[model samples]
Target: MSSESSKKRKPKVIRSDGAPAEGKRNRSDTEQEGKYYSEEAEVDLRDPGRDYELYKYTCQELQRLMAEIQDLKSRGGKDMAIEIEERRIQSCVHFMTLKKLNRLAHIRLKKGRDQTHEAKQKVDAYHLQLQNLLYEEGKYYSEEAEVDLRDPGRDYELYKYTCQELQRLMAEIQDLKSRGGKDMAIEIEERRIQSCVHFMTLKKLNRLAHIRLKKGRDQTHEAKQKVDAYHLQLQNLLYEVMHLQKEITKCLEFK
Candidate 1:
């Protein structure tokens, strides 16, 4: 990324209320900024089938998160815990929003890239194959599902599925291993996770900043109104004092 764009990329410091945490970064601003989701580091669409599965999983995770967030909103509770939960939900939503955009972009960019009917057929076949595998295995989530990419290896189900997929791919495709197949798969997953994290962090911070800024504006407006009220009260008092002095002068003249 250019230095100019880098500077425009402000810090991500979000609180639970979708506001920026004071004097601190949200997430992406801390360490993993500019890792991925850049113009240069576009989404990889070489393996359309794999990308499609990942895209579907990303959508599913987003849906699940949104539902949870809605539920949390509806079931509002007291105090700090609720506040913390809100922040967590806001952050996740921000992250997933970015992920969804990128995944969609990848889908669009890869469109018609595979001109051949055979290539398209294979992609479709792989997609169907994955769906079948999940159904057969009784799994709702995929091996590639990025439920939460912020904490790597926490999505054990996804990691396990990925490892299994890697093993199978290695067995079936001999030439792929020469490119450090399993290791490459792991690396790609990590990078993919980081990319999502990086984007999510950015959006979270932006949203938080906007919320905080709006709050600041509101406070400023309230303060301005208070100042205006005080000024009006002082003017009224001064007017009364002038009237009393005039009456005193009239009384002295009459005497």
Candidate 2:
């Protein structure tokens, strides 16, 4: 009978006040909240491997949410101000990258152009120096040639003058020869006469001889004049020849 009674008795209760079952159930629920929290802590500690997966999922979901927000903004939704600000930041970052790339390209192009310009300047300078050197060489040759030509001209003139003077002297000598022959014949005829004839002949002979002597003297004087003129001409031609030779030597030296 005692064993049957023990089976029918109520078990020991944590909340014995029987106000309403819902109220007691609420109090007991509050009392066990820490235990529920402790059990969750134990599960989280035991599942540390899930942390990386959770982080990855969180990131993917955030990206998806951002994409949805962008779509909503495009469709003219009212809650797109945040999305617009985020897009503006991304656009600024892309714009700055593009600007930096463009600046680097421009700098490279400028450097290439500068190098090309400098190379051209060097080439031009070298060519200009070569041209100036050639011009100077040409001028030197021309000046030397001019100097050489001038000396020969004076020599030619002198030779021509000598020839003319020689011709005139020969003409004078022929005239003197004719006069001397006539005087000699007159003297021979006067030697065979006597008295008044002799006197007249002698007078004619003396006159003829005087005229012959004058002609001979005139011939000698004319010959001497021609010789002196020729000497002067030879001297002038020699001077010119020597000068021309010197100029030719100078030209050779230049070469």
Candidate 3:
């Protein structure tokens, strides 16, 4: 009974390379596969022309194998032979797919290079135009300065313009305050707001000047009107005084 039991037990299967074969692959096969893939990757990176040739060769081989399989099918070829051809076709297809991916990567790399070159050119042109504009602006400011020094009247006009700007900036600030949603103090500290404390002071000074001028004009007009009214009253009073004196003289005669 013990011998029968022992005979019924299955023996461990071993592969020819001496490893247990129960679905276990040989280390050499795995290493060879890895080495092959690594070399292929290296070839793809180092020599694109070689990869292209491989792609072309695979395509031709695939076509020839397909034609041969069709011929064998029509001739009633063995099933094992047909299956072997099919597997070879599958490998060719997979390799061609990798080649196609590499080709697409190359195309995209070239396209990106073109776009970068175009962007660089645009940036250079923009910088050149900016430099020209800066030069013109400096020249204009220098000419204006020369004119200002030659003519002092321009200084007064400039002062007036500055006053106007101050007033306008103040009005804008006041509007912002009235609106009250924005944090004007923080914005000023951050330099996000255009006006500062110095401009606010100028605004106050400008307001005073504007008020003084308006008040003087109003007073002069009122003075002229007052003088005309006083002159009319004096004429009426003199006429009344003369008439009263005449009446008194008549009464004295009667007495």
lDDT digits (tens) for residues 1-255 of candidate 1:
698999999899855887776788767675576564643233332343554466676667666666776676777776546665775776577576567667656554453233233344554576578788988899864322332233333434445555565555434433332243234545544443433333344444445445556767988999999999999999999999999999999999995
Cα displacement (Å) at residue 157, model 3: 52
* RMSD score of candidate 3 (Å): 24.1
Superposition TM-score, candidate 3 onto the true structure: 0.28
Which candidate wins on TM-score?
Answer: 1
Please, what is the TM-score per model? 0.30, 0.26, 0.28
Best by lDDT: 3
What lDDT does model 1 reach?
A: 0.57
Q: Would you list the C-alpha lDDT of every candidate in the order shown?
A: 0.57, 0.54, 0.59
Q: Please rank every candidate by lDDT, starting with the best.
A: 3, 1, 2
- The CA-based lDDT of model 2 is what? 0.54
lDDT of 1 at 249: 97
Which pairs of residues clash in candidate 3, taking residues 3 or more apart in a chain or in different chains? Answer: none
